[model samples]
Target: MERRSNKADKFKYLQPVDRAAIALMLVLIVLIGLLIWNGDRTAPRVRNFSWQNQQVGAEDTSFTLNFNRPMDHASVEANLQIDPLLPGKFSWAGRRMAYTLTAPVFYGTNYKVQLQGAKDKSKTESGKENEKLIDPFYGQFSTRDRAFVYIGVEPQEKGRLILYNVTQQKKTVLTPADMAVNDFKIYPEGRKILFSAADWLSQKPGVFEQQLYTVTTGINPLSPGKPETKPEAAGKINLVLDSKNFQNMKFDLSPDGQAIIVQRVNRNKPGEFGLWVIKPGAPPQPLENQPGGDFLITADSGAVAVAQGQGIAILPMTPKAKPLDFLAQYAKVFSFSKDGASAAMLKFNTNYTRSLFLVTNQGVQKELFKTTGSILDAQFDPRSDTLYCLITRLQKGEQDQDQEQPLLATVDLKKAKMTPILALPNQRDIQMSLSQDGLALLFDQLVTEKKLPKTGALTTNDGQAIVNSLLWLLPITPPTEGSKTQQQQPQQLPLPGFRPSWLP
Candidate 1:
């Protein structure tokens, strides 16, 4: 006991520098303890904050942003901002904030929304603040494309009906503006476009009615003051067969380019329209006499399929073979298969209920799924045997007389099912034409109001003002599956005009 007491006393007599060093070590330990206590008492860190349910062209809109923990509603709403900054008219549903845009967006316009000063509600006792979270979100929705086909409208001017490539970002006007264009078709080799145009001898009315014109793919348009190089202009489009009203007149060039099958209207008599096989440079020849309406040429060998009132018939390419009765009494043909072995037809019951059908060999027919509304038009992809159709449905408060919104759907024969290709909400009057490869779709989406109650009463507004008709190319192969559905988005091609007919 005496020796221990002596040792403790000796340590107490240590130097001032040693005492100071011990004091410093004790202070450092206390500081470390304080930091650990502060960290433990703080709130959980917030992370993975993001938005959801975001789309460009949707009418009903909602957004969902996540937080590390349940957030204070006022704080979250205060941080959310949409620009052209929207006014305070939104409602919050739990963690989601929803609001309808008061103003309709213009076509081809881009929009943005910003979130600022977003943070967790939890705070430290020392009054220190956490890192403020912030981000900006952007999206673009385009207005409906225009309808380029001048159906039911007369071409008044003698200028070239230049079919510009509107699908490209850099606008390339493809057709030359030398002569007036009548009904024209792109050549089987897409390099050359074949159209009928008329040279206007005078500025008199009806002088520029019909003319034949052709322009190669890469030909340059003649500029002012440049030497006038006469582009190869074919002669007038001679009236092969004239009709009183050429409603729904359709024409298809054969694969060999030797003949064109046309749905010609015989104006001299009622119900006189019929299918005619005509040589482009030679005289016209008549095919099987059928009620002339819409017709499609087979993708494989140019066999003609004509749609009558209630049924469809396929005229064989061989001169000796008789026309094959392919469809049933209830089915009508709209499109043909690649090999012309099958056709997409609409099946109707006695009650006028309609369903889609794919007619095949062995007299087999499969019904496409029942649609939500009436199916207006259907097209078959000769390459893939896929059927594309346009469906229309009336909106709320829209009567049977009102124009309906059009939707596009694609039917996969392998799956024996249908999938919606596009849901056009703003579109009023819609018309679509598909390319041969099944990759491109030319559509005229009308935004103007259509004349209703056609009792021959002449009530008129500003004539059908076209918005913008665009051609979009969508890939059909590699069917979209699972999470790869994003690849199904249509690739827009630059086209001068909307209606694009693929070459053979």
Candidate 2:
């Protein structure tokens, strides 16, 4: 009886151990099932996404992207990139991500905003193993094609003006190298480009000046392996009526390519520049008796426009004839109409509060537009009835800042009314030029922050600022009345005959 009782006790003790192991197994199964269920429920999936503002090419622009769920900031930043490597910053609000980029973006260049390898944050109950997520996301978008124009600039290094064919699918350098070109004019035929380059003779170190050179499309084919050719001089480009100490420079060309206007700078005077004209292949004739500055010539007609101290004068093409007595006081001519019947002038007081006026032959100086900011640059369309001007507004409370301007505005003139077309990014030293078809604009966008003058004490004393300028082309639609709808179309042809100096 004692042996049997001992065996029974051992069996009872083993029974408790068996039950405890069974209970532990049950708990493990439950935990595994819960993990499986949560993993299936919380699998990452992408939600719908869109650009913050669909309107592309707007100045000082931003883009927003939506996501299915809150994203890990590190993951998103690791995946996001804007081509051309624009200076930008990224921020997130709720399920949306915003990116703000700096300008001057090449107007028609295809820009890709890419988001790759982004992952969502794991749920709290996803367990410790799910702490780090591996799911990724991707998105891509291109910028709009409108508001792009071609801009050209003359670099001092080689005296070569870089002409960027903004709309061309392939990059083509319109102007060749080894030329000493400064200011240029585009021919009305759109087949030729003209500019004043130091004559081959003047290219030598001791030479004082140069003459105008013409590069014809038919003459200079820009094909590979072809020998580069020099631009032929159309006629004599020299000072005809200036003090021997003054330097003569070509200013503009007539539309028919028959006449050229020249500006003579007086060496002794601080602000003295004189105007003259000569028929191509003929002798030069004086247009103004006294010092004048900033002159423009009509392409269609041989009419000459000159700006004196707050005054403007129009001279007929007749050689050695007195200028027509249509003096505009307190006004400066910016551009002339296609028919040379009207002029676009900026009227300003001593303080420089400016108003744009359309002056007609009928003695009508109508105030087409007024602005609190100063007009930096202006150009007339091929039709001459429309004017495009760049205006700048000073930023508030930032008056002491070296670069305090906040905005650049484009003003349009039509039917005696002035309208604001678009405002550009903050830039300085702005310049505007329109293509012959009026579909493109070439302008300079000042890269202000990057344009810090690299001048030493001696350089500053020499009156030279070390600033870099970038040229850009903006594509635009002609302003049509009552049509708020405008579309940017890619340019099909090279920008030819766009600059006034290139006009034949």
**What overall lDDT goes with each candidate model?**
0.50, 0.54
Each model's number of backbone clashes? 23, 23
Give lDDT tens digits, candidate 2, residues 238-265: 3323335666665777766677777766
Off by over 4 Å in 1: 1-183, 194-215, 218-248, 266-272, 316-322, 380-385, 399-403, 425-429, 433-442, 449-477, 480-496, 502-504
Error of 2 at 315 (Å): 1.9
Put down candidate 1 lDDT per residue, 1-504, tens digits, no spaces.
Answer: 999999999889989999899999999999888976664333323333222212122112233344444445665577666554433355655444455443222222334555555655444568775444433433322322211222221132113333333333322243443443445565532335555444334222322233233455432333222354555432222334333244224566665456666655544453665666666576555564545355666656457666666666667644344666655464456766544667677766666567787777657778876654677778876434467888776666445464556788878776778887687645544556765434456664333345341221111122343334444555544233342223355665544233344332
| Candidate 2 Cα errors over 4 Å, as ranges | 1-159, 162-180, 198-210, 219-246, 266-273, 318-320, 382-385, 397-417, 448-468, 479-481, 485-504
> The CA-based lDDT of model 2 is what?
0.54
